[model samples]
Target: MEEMIKLNSDISVFLYDVLTKRQEKNAKYSLRAFARDLGISPGRVSELLHGRRLPGRDLILRIADALKLSPLETEGLFRLVHRQKLVQKENGGARQLLADEYAMVADLECYGLLMLMETEGFKSDIEWIARRLNVTALRVQSILERLERLNLIRSRYGVYERLQHRVTSTHDTPSDVLKESHANVMKHAMEALYNVDLNLRDITSITIPADPDKLSQAKEEIRLFRRKMAKIMGSGKTREVYNLNIQLVPITK
Candidate 1:
């Protein structure tokens, strides 16, 4: 069983995967039950699973002991958790500022180009990137230069390499830039609705009454959901690049 199990870099994903498998064997098992087994509060477990909190060394050890992870898996979890701490630190400081600044003028195409570099069969050729993004070769070349200047991408031995695994524009992103970025993505979402096959795209919405005061919590949940999907979709052999746009807006006054 240990040999068959694979570990995910995201601790939340790893924990959830174990819970899910256990649930498969015992249908009545639930998060609360799992929390009891792990010797933590249900609320605490929920927060960890939802990405609202990061586990510390003690908590990691408790989880490892409860889950009976192999030594290799336990060490892998420690590494991943430490890496996550570093990322969180970066996101709260200078790296996040650089990312936000890049987003302000980078445009949608620039973001797309960055992700494209991660896909399988990716080539460093300007024309190839331009064709993939439906932009001019000049546009792709210019974006490459801008990214290189930012040290977000670098050319080594004739190969372009991506430096950042993620880029997000959060609270500090200029209002105008944030608006324009959303507008650009919304336009593409509209286009995909008509031109792209349903199998390739998921464009849907739900209309429900929601309290204004709780919006902050809702937005955080959406952010967590996006991160979870990013990890899941990015697993295995990534062959193509895709956009994930989730919008929750108020239609009623």
Candidate 2:
């Protein structure tokens, strides 16, 4: 049996190495079995190994998990895949995120799913997540799959975990998608205002004259404030999840 060697930047070679290592342990191992274990079709796996196709980020993560790669190896694989994506983009072959993908980023429930995973009482059950996020179990199921495809979350042995602490909508996201997300958040805030106990929630606002020229600086300050509050609230014995929404918009323009 050979020890795992240093993986090259080429995914094809890395995959070949994985296959060879498995064959060393079990001479009966077949390509179909390999593909099955990796959760990809045999033809697609062949294309990847033959360098006819590059693995997408989702496929890369799936392969990494199937191979049970070490943390360092997983990071290396991601770097390689990202470089490949850059090359594809430069070659005008890059696939942009589909509208559905953008919608996932713009879904406020998706953000709630991530945050809920951090709470002390978090459960991976769809019903539990649905209840916690105020969404239907079906919606929770859809968001879980979408988040996994985005590599923001992963499930292993029936336990789901957040790969990222937070995610922001990409700058390229359409205005309507962003607006939909913001509207959802605002709706939640409104509900909490009347339904939640005053001691358990805080909703405060202030309006002041502002300089439009310094709007960028003001945005940066807000970003920092959000991070500061996240750190403060995330510390010590977290039992619940909360969202902090801040709005900075002109009333008259």
Candidate 3:
């Protein structure tokens, strides 16, 4: 239990630092090589650093032994291992929790429900939310429950609050899940284009011939614009949910 109290607090940072330092010393050090040295699969190391998986006791000890950790680091590693056990016992481990959230996001209505929860006129009533979002009240209730379980949203006095306001996806999100989400969002946008009033919707697109080399810089520009929009929208005056999708693809053959 002493180890549990003295844990590293963030194993992701520790493993990333170790990988970086080792790469500095060994020019040819790849993620595969790093994982081999630590006696684990490259995929496992990737997942650990990405905050998708947690290591068990034996694997943690083996990693420490292979890294030839300092005495203090060994203590810290043991603590990390013990902490993982406790988290697993209490929350069914990181993978299970992430999987549940991923599955939740797979449902487009659930995704819309989260965004709708942020509107100033947000309603805690499932029937209201379902009617507003064009989904069933039962589904709205179920999605709210799932969101609460995943800690993505919290409830107090029956009002739902978004726990994580930053809208971002995991680095290692499944491709199919992302694709399906994109498809659903596209369908919604198409429907809105015809149904929503011009004063309430903004949809514009341009087709231009562009150099491929400049596309990377264009992407950076979009990223910066999105970040700026997020900050501007953070002023506590949010009254509506909007989707801003930027697309850059080849059209010239």
Tens-place lDDT per residue, model 2, 1-253, is: 0133243434665676677678889989988999999999999997776555888778877988888888777777878767656655553442233355668667677777877888897888999888877789999999889877655566756999764443343346688887888898999999999999999999998999888999999998998898799889999988888889999999987
> In what order do the candidates fall by lDDT, top score first?
1, 2, 3
Across 21-93, the per-residue lDDT of candidate 1 in tens digits comes to 7888998998889999999999999767645577999999898889888888777778877766776675742
Question: Which candidate tops lDDT?
Answer: 1
Better of 2 and 3 by TM-score: 2
Q: What C-alpha lDDT values do all the predictions have?
A: 0.75, 0.74, 0.70
Where does candidate 1 stray beyond 4 Å? 1-87, 90-94, 103-105
In model 3, which residue pairs have backbone atoms overlapping below 3 Å? none
Which regions in candidate 2 have their CA more than 4 angstroms from the true location? 1-100
Q: Candidate 2: lDDT over CA atoms?
A: 0.74
Which portions of model 3 miss their true places by more than 4 Å?
A: 1-100, 233-236
Displacement of residue 17 (Cα, Å) in model 2 is: 15
Alpha-carbon lDDT of model 3: 0.70
TM-score of each model, paired residue for residue = 0.62, 0.62, 0.59
**In model 1, what are the clashing residue pairs, if there are any?**
none
